[model samples]
Target: MSKLDSLLAIPVLDRSNQPRIQAAVDGKAKPPRALGRIEELAVQLAVIQKKSLPSVRQPQLLVFAGDHGLTRSGVAAFPSGVTVSMVDTLLAGRASANAFARVVGARVSVIDAGVAADLSDRRGLIHAKIAMGTQDASKAPAMSTDQVISGLLAGADIATQAIGDGADLICLGEMGIGNSSSAALVIHRLAPAPLEICVGPGAGHSPEGLAHKHMVLAKAAARTDAAEPLEVLTQFGGYEIAMMAGALLASAKAGVAVVVDGVICSAAALIALRLAPQALDYCIFAHASVEPGHRVIMEALEAKPLLDLDMRVGEGTGTLLAIPLLQAACALLSDVADLKDVLEAAS
Candidate 1:
């Protein structure tokens, strides 16, 4: 069987430790449920790991970079070349994601899922390009079924490698210029929301530019009638997003925590969750994006993110910011003493 097929065989996370995790969290020295979302996060990590005390010591943040064909239609405020430059910045460890990784003590890696430029010479970047770039969805299907499968398989392999190298937690991020438009379309179809609701100003767009983007996205959406998750992804075409989806599947299968970043990453999560409804058990929605469509997708997934930072910078920046909370959760569960134990000591 193909790698993608093997990843799909992942069973739903076993919840046998549900009571033990909840009991452990409640036994913390704090009052009942006083820790709020952190407690919930701790329980989630525990359940995913099948242990009452979980650890987030080793985190791998994979920033999948690609180019969108929709950019050629003036959907983005920046040029598509910016995607290439950003990939180079990531490789040089000069991007904001790199800085954030340093601060959070997480390892950062960039993958050339499908950039329009030739980045083969980049020293540290992972080479897994599915193509130069996807076709313009406004004119044709963004990718073929085979391309979508290949991208997903490539992503799964990258994620598996990270896990094998000691990544207990994986965060998803993406850098693709026109991908916001692609993400919007993916949300529109997969979330079953209105096209207008899914379109937003990505990477900063003027009012007129945003309007033109809506028009272009509408044209692309009308080009295909694919409502299924994978079909929608294939119709919209985004190598980075597809790879992110693959990574999500692989991480969940390996019983690791997956920190989902902003709208684009969440769009990829939607595809993965649709394929394997159980993968949601391993997902941790890092933060709520300022992008309007994000709420729609979140609501569709019935996921409540850990933070509402009103941030829209994708490149896994939000994920990096949220990693500390996961660490704190782990500490709260593992390091803190039980309330009864503290009381006995006091007596």
Candidate 2:
């Protein structure tokens, strides 16, 4: 079978231990459910890990970089060249994501999924370019089905490598100019939502710019009726987005929690979850993006993000912020004393 087929066929997360995990959380010394979502997060981690006491000691944050040709249609306020510059910044450890990763104690790795420029000489950048960015979807399909499969395999390898190197958690991030536009089309098709509701101001567009972007994306959306996850992705998804979807699948197969960031990453998650619905059991939606379309996608996945910071800056910034919460949840599950133990000690 193809690699994508193998990934899709991987067994869903085992839940036989879920009741045990929940009981362990309820047995914590804190008032029952007082910890709220943190308690829920702890249970999820334990169930994903198949351990009553789970810890996220080795967290890896992967920022996949690519470029979208849709920018050629004036769909974005920023030029597409910014994608290359940001990839450099990420590799140089100067981007906001790097700074946040430092604070959160996550090792940041940047992958060149499909940047529209040659970056083969960059040190410390994972080279997995499927193409020099995708083609303009408004005019034609962004990429071929084979390209999507290749991107997915490359991404799955990256995640598997990180997990092999001891990553207990993976946080998804992306950098690609006009990628939000690509993500909008993907969400529009997969969420089965109206194209108008799926369009949003990406990177702060002016009134006319926003209208133009919406128009261009609508044209792209109209070009295809692919509701299948892979087909929709092939028609409109970015290389980084496809890679992120593959990484999500690999992480789920290996039983690692993935903290999905922002609207772009959420679009990736939509594709991953659509392919294997059980992958949601392994995903932790980090935060809601300022992009309005994010809500539509989140609703499609039946997911509520842990945070709603009015932040639009992608590159896994939200994922970094959510790591501490995951760590806290693991601590609650593993470090907190049992109610009986606490009461016995008090007596």
Model 2 segments more than 4 A misplaced: none
Write the residue-wise lDDT of candidate 1 on 1-347 in tens digits: 86667888888788888888899889889989999999999988888988877898899999999999998999999999999999989988999999999999999999999999998889998999999999999999899999999999899999999999999999999999999899999999998899999988989999999999999999998888999987999999599999999999999999898999999999999999988888998999999999988898899999998889889999999899999999999999879999999999999
lDDT digits (tens) for residues 1-347 of candidate 2: 86778998757789999988888889889888999999999889988898888998889999999999899999999998999999999999999999999998999999999999999899999999999989999999999999999998889999999999999999999999999899899888899798888888888799999999988998888787888999999999989999999999999999899999999999999999899998898999999898988999889988999998899899999999999999999999768889999899899
Write down the TM-score of every candidate: 0.98, 0.98
* Count of backbone collisions in candidate 2: 0
Residue 234 displacement (Å), model 2: 1.1
What are the runs in model 1 whose C-alpha is more than 4 Å off? none
What lDDT score is found at residue 337 in candidate 2? 88
Candidate 2 residue 250 C-alpha distance from true site, Å: 0.6
lDDT for every model? 0.92, 0.92
Clash totals in order: 0, 0
